[model samples]
Target: MPKPSAVTEAPSVVGSRLRQLRQRQGLSARELAHRLGISPSAVSQIERGVLQPSVARLIAMTDALGVPLAEVFGGPEQRDEMPEDLTGFALQRFGQGTEMTLESGVIFRRVSPGRTPGVDYFVSTYPPGSAAHPESGMFRHEGYEVGTVLSGELTIDFDGERVVLRAGDAISYPCSRPHRIHNTGSVDAVAQWLIVHPER
Candidate 1:
């Protein structure tokens, strides 16, 4: 098989990170999901990055994994710049998102089924004042997660208490909390996330 390039290597690296963390904790996907207050499917999705997890979800995953920001985004394989064409895969950008009721210029990248992974990797943007809620009253995450806010104001919601985060603010939270994310500034919000899960 041909060796994957650096850009292609990132998702796998991210996936591997999650798998390793999950193994360290000796937890199963279903078990982690239960602990994170989300469904196993969601856990699977996060591990694959087929879905963009909210800032709230990232915190929950990081709490579960017990790792720090540098471990997630600063990991070696992720150091490559995003691909110009990205070959066979594609990224979708929208003014609206599925997690919330309004269009907020959110950008999402589909990681799994589209790309091979040693771990999950995603690049997403949240416009100022854009936020995400649990689907139809459902909320929560599935494992230890981490996030690096790239721009604007990020509001991390833990139940009703809110943590207003700005550029360069990093966070870790337990997935079991009722959480949500909102862009509370006048500019666009961009962030990268990593979530880990037990090996399948």
Candidate 2:
């Protein structure tokens, strides 16, 4: 008797390949999620090696990406995972007082010390009437900037276009766009950012 087709379990590899397919198709996470009938956060988590999809979801992903199921779960080519360091953190705190006040209710801050400086890393929480810190600076930086609005309201200025974002939304903006953030809400807003640079 012939054996049934099987899919190996590889959360990391599958997730990475899924992202690769999305990029090749020129589809953003939001776009992919819209196709998959899931939230962008779900797609982001799946791509970041955080969440593994079920059999049904795997079929959906393959169909949406127009790829074979084997390809989705088959690429483990990245290499063995390396150990991560959790030291050298100078300080860590919570609450609005310790964060940078960009505006009346906007707070900007680096998620951790010794992170990529020009990366402009942060998890800002903006209250009503609060605006993002870059209201005036509208600075430019090297590398890429990607962020996910975990909650509340957020806005990003890309050149001259304003993209208003809500909870579970994500955005990828070129650091060369002279962009800035704005928190226009009557409630608290929060988002996480990731920036790439030469070294830690």
Candidate 3:
């Protein structure tokens, strides 16, 4: 038998973050849904992480909440005290960044020391045979993603097309396209992801 992959299960923090921001703004779920032009159940699903929001919806959500896009992804301090100068810099040591796991069993480590404008950086690890979406399904969001495989193998499926990548291989694509990534190899796969979001 083959050895088990390094990753097992990972959980996403998006729902928690959404809930936190909503409460901070003193908006109830129904009120938020009304502002977003979505149903209350839809808002519930998003806040519960049962459904992921599209890029456009995410922008509308931030606008409704009167917060920057980075506020949604940043820690409490970063959200509260976002620097106005992009030139300001900080360092993040190995294993020191914010870590999260998605429902798909992928581990994500935020690489930046704190929230920066325009982009979100992450190091992701996928377990063998694991996928970002269910088989034949896909997920779409906002922004552009650039990634390179660091170890094992990664398979990206965009629409009906599939591309397999080995270590050192890289890919860049729009997040608007329906897509998913899978660990097709028999070992854990690690990759670095850079997601660029539109300026607010």
Candidate 4:
């Protein structure tokens, strides 16, 4: 079997929507950068699609803008426009979902057709040597994650303990733990991840 290739193209919509959100929040690029502890030029680069932020940075950006991460991916406005299905179901066709390739070389594609209150469903691809937290090594949030490795190998580090997962393996853990996801294999590691956010 052939190894899955890395997804290199990041949709420009993410950048544009982020910019719109920042502007709508009445924040200048410099102010946003200050809040993110990054340079103004870095913010501009990300907003213009010249640079792609790592997942951590993107999350911080959205939080600083007083919006949920989903807002960066079309948000409630887009979700509200989906064609109604009295049958109570909708489909998220292949390539129709939002895709973003981070600077760490990880690709996150939202797979859920619409909002699932406090839930996030997505496919994540981690290229060889890539890590969810490239610098910090670990981070924690308010939620829980359940994921299964579709291919390649991935390692999850919780504090000092490390758990390795191979293709077809699955794991579930609380997001409150300081952890990091790393691709330790030579091939791209792809997984379907579901995150259930803590109630607000």
List clash counts for every candidate, in order. Answer: 21, 0, 1, 0
- Residue pairs with colliding backbones in model 2 are none
lDDT of 2 at 66: 61
When sorted by lDDT, best at the front, the candidate numbers are 4, 3, 2, 1
TM-score of each: 0.44, 0.43, 0.71, 0.79
lDDT of 4 by residue, 4-31 (tens): 3423344466788889999999999999
Q: On residues 1-200, what C-alpha lDDT tens digit does candidate 2 reach at each position?
A: 55222223345655777899899889999999998788999999888768755423554575677653334422343111112353434333343112333225344444543322334455666776555432355655445768899888887776768899999999886656676666666678888777554332
Query: What overall lDDT goes with each candidate model?
Result: 0.55, 0.59, 0.72, 0.78
Comparison by lDDT, 1 against 4, better one: 4
- Which lDDT tens digits does candidate 3 get at residues 1-200? 55223222122366668778899999999999998778999888877778765434554576677664456554576553436775666665554455555545666665666656678776778889777664557766667889999999999988889999999999999988988788889999999888888666
TM-score-superior candidate, 1 or 3: 3
User: Cα lDDT of model 4 overall?
Assistant: 0.78
- Where's the lowest-lDDT run of ten residues in candidate 3? 3-12
Q: Whose lDDT is greatest here?
A: 4
Candidate 1 lDDT tens digits, 1-200: 54222222244444555656776778898888887788999778767755555544554665566543223443343323334356545332342111211123454442332222224445456776666653424256555557778777777767657788777988876545667777778887767666554344
